[model samples]
Target: MKFPIAALLLCLAVSGASAEATYGAPPSGLADHLARLKRAYPDVILDYDKTKLTLKSGATIPISDGRRDKSFDELLDEPDIDDMFAFPYPAHAKPAAPAFNADPGRVRVESLFREIYGDCRQGAAALKMRRVPWFGGSVLITTRQGVDKALEAVSRDLEKLPKAMQKYLAPSAGTFNCRAIAGTTRLSTHAYGASIDLNTDFANYWRWSKAGKDRKVTWTNRIPAEIVDVFERHGFIWGGRWYHFDTMHFEYRPELLAR
Candidate 1:
C-alpha cells in the first residue's frame, strides 16, 4: 500500500515547522526579560521609541535592523531602540552557553557616546573630569552624561562588598583616555571614561587564548557572580559575559539595560 501524496507533504510541513520552532527563533520572553531589567534598574530607560532609544540624558541612539556594525560616528548620530539590547544577558535561570550570534551588548556606534561624553582625546572637554574612589584609592574618569554620578553609585555599592572581593578593583587600571580600540580606529569605551577594568591579574582577555586559527575560545570566569550582580543592578554589564570575554571589566551603558 502507498501513502497519499498530500499526507506525505503534510508530514514534511509539520516536521519543518517543528525544526524551525526548535532552532530558528530566539527565546520567546524578550519582553519579559526587558521588564526584569527595568525593575532591577528603574529610570534607566529614557525612551523606547520603536527602533530608537533616547536616554534620560536626551541622547538618542538608533537600533540597527540586526545587519552590520554602525560606525562610531553613525552610532553617536542616530541609535535605534534595538541597538540598546545589542548585548545579550543570561537567557535562562541557570547559566547556559551563549547562542551563536548571541552578542547582545556588542553593538555600539561610537559617535553616540562621543556626542554625550565628549571626545576625551580633545583635552578641551575631558578637563572637566573628576575622580571616583573604586576600592580605597580613586580613579580619574569623565563627568559627562551623569557618568560621574553613576560611577559614584557603583563605588558606593562596591565598597560594601567583603574585603577579598574589593581587592580585585584597586590600584586602578585607569580611565578617560582618548584612544582607539587596541587594533582598530574605532573608539573604545575607555575613550569615553564609561568603562573600567579591574586588577589585570584577576581578568581575562580574548587575545590571551591561543588556539589554532579559527580555534574556539574557551570561556573561563573567576570573578564572583556577586560582583557581576552588583554592576548589573547599577546598569553596568560585565565583559565576562561576552564571547570575547574581558572578565574584569564593566562599562556604563545604561541604555543596554534600559527597558
Candidate 2:
C-alpha cells in the first residue's frame, strides 16, 4: 500500500504492547517519511530524495550513511539523518507509557541541529536567543524558525488553562541551556535554545526511577493531556510521548508537526 507522495501522512500510532516491542523499527516507507519532513520545514529543508536531504542553504546531507545492522545502543548513542525519524511522534494523543524503546523525536543528528541553530556552546545558538513573555516572567528561547513566536502563542493559550494547571507551568525548570543531555555526551535540543522543561515538581524522568534488571522502565506522568495538546497545537512535541519518557519536557520540532 502506497500513500500519495504529496499527502505523505507521516504519523501513525501503535497501541498496546506493539508500541513498545516494535517502535524502534523504521517506518516501512522511507520516501513518505522524508516527504513529510520536506513538507514540514519548507524553509529549512528544500528536498529529500532518499539518498540525500538538501537544505535551502545549498548544503546536502546524506539521508543514510549506510551504517546498517545498528544495535539499540547505537540508535540511542548515534543516529544518522534517517534514523531520527525511525519512530513516529504521536501528536495530539493523551500521554501513555510508550512501547519499549519507542523514543521518537529524541534521536536527533547533532550536526543537522547545529547547522540550523548554530553551536550554542560557542555562543552561536545563544546569540539567536530572544526573550518571550510567559505566565509571570519572560523565558529565553531561540528566534530561529519562528520558535519564539510559537512559544509566545503557547504561553498565551496556557494562561487560559485552569488556575490549577498553572503550577505545572510556572517557574519553568529552565530553557536554552547549552549542556549535554544527562548521561549522554550529545548536546540536547535545549542546548540549541529550542526546547524547554516545565515545572520539575510535577515532572517524571525515567532515570529518576529504579530500572529493573531487564530495564523495563516504569513510566509516569503528572502533566495533563490538556497541557500536552496546547504544546502540540503550537508546534512543540512533548517528551512524555516517548517510551523513554520525560514528562516535563517539550521541544520545538516543527518538522514532526508539519503533518
Candidate 3:
C-alpha cells in the first residue's frame, strides 16, 4: 500500500523541529512528557502504552491528533493530549522572565481535566468543591484528588507568616467560579476549583498594561515573593512567571512545580 504524500510530508515536518516544541503535531518527547504527567497525577492517568492511554474510565484516548501545522491560536483552541506538553514547563527554574512563547502549563487538554474533575457544564465538577479555611475565613476549593488536603496544608503554613502578609491573602478575590475565561471559550482553571486568585488590589494582569510598539508585554509583579514562595512550596504554580504575567494567580499544578 502506498502511503499518502500528506503523511510523508507530516513526518518530515515534525522531524525538523522535535527539540524545542511543536505546535500542531505530536512531539518526539511524548514518553518523557507523559511520564511526568503520570508522576504528577497518578489517580486519573492510570496507564499508557506510548501512543495511547487506557484511562481510569477504561476509555482509550490518542496521544496525538497527527496534524503538523498549527498556529499559536490553533494550538490553544484545539490541542491533543500530547500538545499539552509541547512546551517544556520550567519547573522551579527561577523567578526570572520567561521566553516569549513559554506558557507551558497554559495549554491544557479539556478532556483530561473533564475526566478527572467532571464536566463543569453539567455541574458535576462543582459538587466536588469544598471550602478550605484560609486566613481565618473559608474559601471554596476542590476536594477531588487530595486538593482539599493540600490546600489545608497550605493554609496551615500561611498562618505562620508575618502579620503583614495577611492583607494580601484576603479578602479573597475568588475560587471555584464555574465560568469560562473572559474573551475565550476555554474555562479558567478556577472553574475546576483547583486554582485561586488572591486580592485584586495587589494583583496585576497583562491585559491592563500597555504593550510596547513592538507588541511585547511588560512583565510586572507586586504580590510579594514571600506569598509566592508559600504557594510554590504547596504545589502551586505562579502566574508571575509567564511572559503575559498575572501576579495574583496561582493554580495547583504540581507537575509544573517540582517539590
Candidate 4:
C-alpha cells in the first residue's frame, strides 16, 4: 500500500516539533549535574565522565559505588560522590522541619571534600586559612575555592539585617577546627575550615534535644531566617534544614546549591 504524501509530511512535522521540544527542555539528570559540579569548583574539578570525576591534581574519584541498598547511616559513612545528592537541597525555601533522614548536604564524600578543601590532619587546611572579620572578631576559614570570601560576603549581608539579629551571629561558636564530628571518626566540614557555627547560645542540636516516644528527635530553630538567608546566598547551607538539626551550623557546599 502506498502512503499519502500529505499525511506523511504532516507526521514528519509533528516528529520534528517533538524532538525540538525535548532538546530544548531544561537541563537535568547526571550529565547536567556533573556539569554543575565542574562549574561549582572550576579550579578543582577538572572534568568528569559517566562513572568518575577527574580532579586538577591528576586524581580521579568514582562517582558511585554501585550500591543502592545503603541505609541512612551507611549513606552518611560510606558515601560516594553520587551519594552527595541523596537529598536535593531545598535552597531558599522557607525554613521548616525536614522529613526524616532528609539531610541534603550531609552525605559528604570525604575524598571529594579533601580534594576541594585540603585535609586538616597534616595541617594542610590550616595553611590555606584566612582570618575573615566576623561580628567584632574573626574566624579562620579556607581560601580554597574562595570560601573565605564567601563567608565574608555572608557576614556583610548579615550585618545589614536589624541589630537584634546580631545576637545570633556574634561570638561565633567556632570555625576551622580540625576535629571529627561528634561520635564519629569522620572529619567534620569544620575540619576543612569551610564551616561556621553561629552563637552556641541560640543553637539547638538533635543530640541535645529530647526524643519523643516514637524516638524521633524534635526539630527546633532559634536562628532567624534572615541569618540563614545570608549564608545560603553565599553558598553556605544551614544545618538547621537537616532533619538532624544543628541550628547554629552553616557550611560552604556550593555544589549542592548550584542551580
Candidate 5:
C-alpha cells in the first residue's frame, strides 16, 4: 500500500510505538519529524528540508548522516537529527516493559542540542539556566524553550497528588549538571539543563543491577504511575520507560510526544 509522506509521518509521530525502523533512514521520512521539531521548539527551529534542519540562529544540521547501518552505540554517540526519533516515546501510555534496546529519546544529536541549549563544556548551557521551584526548594533548568515553565507546570500538577507521593519527589537527585553520561563522553541531557532527576532514594537504575549470562537487567520501577503521568503531561519523557531504566529521571523532549 502507498501512503503520502505527510500522512505517514504524522502517523509515526502520534503512534504509541515510533516508526523507528521506517524513519531512521536519512531523507526517507524526515519531513514529519522535522515538523515535530519545529513545533516542539517553535521559537528555535527555523525550517527544514529533505537534507537539513535550520535553527533560528541560522545554523544548519544534516537531517541524517545517510548511514543506515549504525550500531545502537553509534546511534547513541553519533546520531543525526533524524536518529533522535529512532524510537517512539509512549507519552501518557501505561508503563510497560520496554523491548530490549527500546530506549526512546536516548539517541540524541549532540550538535543539535548544543545548538539548541548551548554546549556545557564551554559554559554556554549554564548561561541559559533559570531556577524553577520544585517541591519546597528550587532546581536550575534551562529557560530556553520555556522548559523552566514546563517544570513549573509539572510541579503544580505533582503537588495535587496525595502527600505520600511526596517522598519520591523532594530533594531531587539533581538537575543542570555539566557532565557526560557516566562512562560516555557524550553530553547528557542534564548538561543541557533540560532534564531533572527525582529523589534517588526510590530510584532503580539498570546499571546498579547485575545482569546474568543473558546480560539483561531486570526491569524495576519504584516511581508511581501517578507521578510519571504528570511529567509526561508536561512534555517530560521518563527514563523509567527505557530498557536501560533509570526510574528517577525525566527529560523535556516534546518532539517525541507530538500527539
Candidate 6:
C-alpha cells in the first residue's frame, strides 16, 4: 500500500538528517502532516509566514530553525514549530536508540505548557482533575486538554497485558506534583500534571550514573520496550529516550508525537 505523501516525505527527511536524535532532524513529512491537521481542524490554521504555524483561530506557533540551545522555558512556551521535534519518538521500534541526541520531543518552553496545562501549584488550576486506576489502584491526574482521556486510554490498554507484565506498573511512584526539577528552578513536567513516574526499582536515571572526569553525566536506560510502547501509543513520551535518561518517567505531549 502507498503511504501518505507526508509519510513519504517524513521518511526522506529522517533519512537525510543525522540519525542521532529522533526529533533532531526537521520533520520530513511536516508539510503533509500539517495539511492533514488542517483538514482535521480547519479552525486551527489561519495563515503562515515561511516558518510560522498560524492557526485560523488566532494562535501562531513558530518553527525552530534548528540553531541554538533554547532554554527549557523558551522551548516549552515559545518554541518554533520546528522545535516540536526536539526529541525523536520511535516511528517504528528498532533495537537501538535513534542516534546520539536524537531526542525530538524533548524540548519544552515552560510558558507554553503553563499556557495550556495550567500551573499545578495554584490549587484552582489542577482542580479539574480525575483518577485513573493504575495497575488496579487509583491515581489522581489532571484532566486538562483531554489529558485525562489520554491517560485513561493508556490505563485501559495496559490492563489487557498479562498479570506478570502488569506488576511493574502498580505501586506507581507518582503522577501530579508541583515541584522543580532536581537542582533546577525550572519547573518540571510534573508541575503541569502531564507526567508520571513508574516503579523506581526497575528504573534508571542518568544522574545515578557515575560522572566522568569532566563531571558530565552519561546516559543509560533499563526500562523495557514492552512498557515504553504502551505509553507512547497513548501520547506519552518515555524519559528513557533521553540522552540524559530518566527511565521511569512519561508525559503527555501529542504535538511532539505529530510526526
The model with the greatest lDDT is 5
Q: How accurate is candidate 5 locally (lDDT)?
A: 0.84
TM-score for each predicted model, relative to the true structure: 0.68, 0.86, 0.84, 0.86, 0.87, 0.72
The candidate, 4 or 5, that scores higher on TM-score is 5
Clashing pairs for model 3 are none
Compared with the true structure, model 6 gives a TM-score of 0.72
Task: Please identify which of the two predictions, 1 or 2, would achieve the higher TM-score against the true structure.
Answer: 2
Off by over 4 Å in 3: 1-22, 25-29, 124-126, 212-214
Q: What is the clash tally of candidate 3?
A: 0
Error of 1 at 30 (Å): 9.3
Top candidate by TM-score: 5
Off by over 4 Å in 2: 1-26, 124-127
| Model 1 lDDT per residue over 52-82, tens place | 5456667656544453445433433344434
Task: Give the local distance difference test score of model 6.
Answer: 0.66
- Scored against the true structure, residue 159 in model 3 reaches a CA lDDT of 83
Q: Which digits, one per residue and each the tens of the lDDT, describe model 6 over residues 39-90?
A: 4333335555557666544666665557554444445444555566555466
Tens digits of per-residue lDDT, candidate 5, 66-127, equal 88866566778778888887777778778778987789889888877887788788875454
Computed on alpha carbons, the lDDT of every model, listed in order, comes to: 0.62, 0.81, 0.77, 0.83, 0.84, 0.66
Model 2 poorest 10 in a row by lDDT: 14-23
Ranking by lDDT: 5, 4, 2, 3, 6, 1
Candidate 4 residue runs with Cα over 4 Å from true position: 1-28, 124-127, 212-215
**Cα-based RMSD of candidate 5:** 10.3
List per-candidate RMSD values in Å.
9.6, 10.7, 6.7, 13.5, 10.3, 11.8
**Model 2 compared with the native: what TM-score?**
0.86
After superposing all C-alphas onto the true structure, candidate 3 shows an RMSD in angstroms of: 6.7
lDDT of candidate 2 at residue 55, scale 0 to 100: 90
